[model samples]
Target: MRLSCLQENLSKGLAIVGRAAASRSTLPITSNVLVATDEGRLKLSATNLEIAVSCWIGAKIEEEGATTVPAKLLTEFIGSLPNDKIEMALSAKKILTMKCARFEARMTGVDARDFPPIPRVENGVAVKVDVAEFKKGVARVVFAAATDESRPVLTGIDALFEGSVLTLAAADGFRLAVYKMPLAEAASQKVKAIIPAKTLSEVSRLLSDGDESIGITVDTQKSQILFKLKNVELVSQLLQGAFPQYSQIIPQSHTTRAVVETPAFLMAARTAQIFARDGGGIVRLIMTPGGGKTPGRLSITARSEEIGEDQAELDAAVSGEEAKIAFNGKYLLDVLGVISEGQVALEVTGPSSPGVIRPVGTDNYVHVVMPMFVQW
Candidate 1:
């Protein structure tokens, strides 16, 4: 194999595909990145048994061949080279040789045929989604996925595509996050799949700022999902199991509603977290509505018996009735940090019930947090 490519493109491609290379795996080939010439471009791929990433970069191919090299070594070496042309060649003994500018190196590699084959999915129900909206939805929903491996279903995001809409829902048993966005193209039939949060996060990160749309294919026959970007492709195995019926978890109505500014609420939560760290991570939220010409108030407080207590108040648009709720300080910070709207609405039925949070101007997102059982 012989090929020449720009250092910049090779470096970027390595960085993108190297993410899937397994650091510690039972299969040694999974730690290597497969390099080959496809059509008129160079293809770099890596897999860790769960997900695979493939990136194509332009190159001048003198001969057609393939080999697997250490991902970390190649990425580091290519990244250290200057912005110049890199010439690479492979020998029959599985030796990968490369030259860039004034530097040259030869490394031992493995036969490419031993590397895991990336599942090729062509016949499947495909849906296109706007890149910007898809990234936003992933950012809002993936954080709620369960990190514990005991419940496998909760570790994945519930993806539902029907007609022209796509919904992403994730939960960790304590909190739930749901986001909906219009698809760039309409789907022919309803499709449901549970995609791992880690894979979706990587897909979101791979989407460049210049990308306009992303194509998602649900291949039920293969039990895998594929994401196709402009120059990159990601394939992940679907988790087998039934996701929770999350539609019933979202509250339909609320007795107490409070509208608070996003920045203010986030700031209060951040401050409360500092003190709540010593107090079992509990933060208290008290909403008081005003009558006549008086203004409404929302108090955020946290206390530690060994340390001290702190509280911050913000003017809010409160209605219905007064409410006091205790919540995990970290949970409050997580949901509030994702909200970008000017004001956020909080709906609570009572101290024992879950609190629903929604951005005032957007109906596309909703978050539910269970209240902590603590003394008032």
Candidate 2:
């Protein structure tokens, strides 16, 4: 294979697909990125069996062939080269020769035939979504996915499409996040599937690179989902299982509700985390109702045997009865960190029941966190 391409375009493609390449796997070929000539363009692809990413770069293809090279080495080498055009040629022995302004290197690679075939989106149901809205929906829920893969379904985000609405949900047992958005084009058929959080996270990043609408294809027959953004496409295997029934867990009504500033609440929780770390990462929220002329206030506190205590009070608009609840500091902070700037509403049924959180004046997203059992 012989081709010449711009340094910036090639570098960006490598960086985007490199994340899907396996570093150390039983199959050595999975560590390599397949470079090929496709209809006057250079196609770069990488896969770890679960997810596959392909990016095409504009290139001058002198010869038609393909080869697989170490993803890390090629990515680093291409990124270090100058902004000039890069010429690459592969010999019969599968050695890749790369040259730019003053740099020259030869790297041995494996034949492209040994690489796994990436799934393609052919005649599948496609839907269009607003890039900014889709990204925001993904951010609001992806972090809540389970990091520990004990429950495979929980490690992914549950994507449910019905008519013109799309709902994305993620949960780690301790907390659950759900975001809803309207799709630009209504899907012809309803579908539900669990997609790996890692894949969704990468797709979210790719959306920012372009201002165009994103195209999503769900091929349920092949159990593969495809996300198309500009010249890049991501294909991932759908996790086969039913996500937990999360709607029943969310409290219908709260005994107490507190509306507090997002930044102030986040800052107080972060400061308290310093002390909460030593004591099961516990952060307590105490809400009180206002009387005739007094304003309601929410008291945030954390304490530990080794570390001192931290306490702060923020004025809040409280409704219903007064209540105090204990929660894992990290869990609370995680939800607060991703919330868009504005006031947030906290709803609690009791000290032991789960607490619900949602941004004020917006019904698009909601988070439910299970309260910790603590003696107070």
Q: What TM-score do all the candidates reach, one by one?
A: 0.99, 0.98
lDDT of each: 0.95, 0.92
**Model 1, residue pairs in steric clash:** none
Error of 1 at 340 (Å): 3.3
The sequence of per-residue lDDT tens digits that candidate 2 reaches over residues 150-245 is 899999999988899999999999999999999998889998888999989999987764556888998888889999888899999998888999
Give candidate 2 misplaced runs (Cα > 4 Å): none
The per-residue C-alpha lDDT of model 2 at residue 240 equals 86
Question: What local lDDT score does residue 33 receive in model 1, on the 0 to 100 scale?
Answer: 98
Name the TM-score of candidate 2.
0.98
Span of 10 residues, lowest total lDDT, candidate 1:
333-342
lDDT of 1 by residue, 1-376 (tens): 9999999999999999999999999999999999999998999999999999999999999999999999999999999999999999999898999999999999999999999999898877898999999999999999999999999999999999999999999999999999999999988899999999999999999999989999999988898999999999999999999999988988898989999999999999999999999999999999999888888989999999999999999999999999998999998899998885589998999999999999998899999999999998
Q: Best-fitting candidate, measured by lDDT?
A: 1
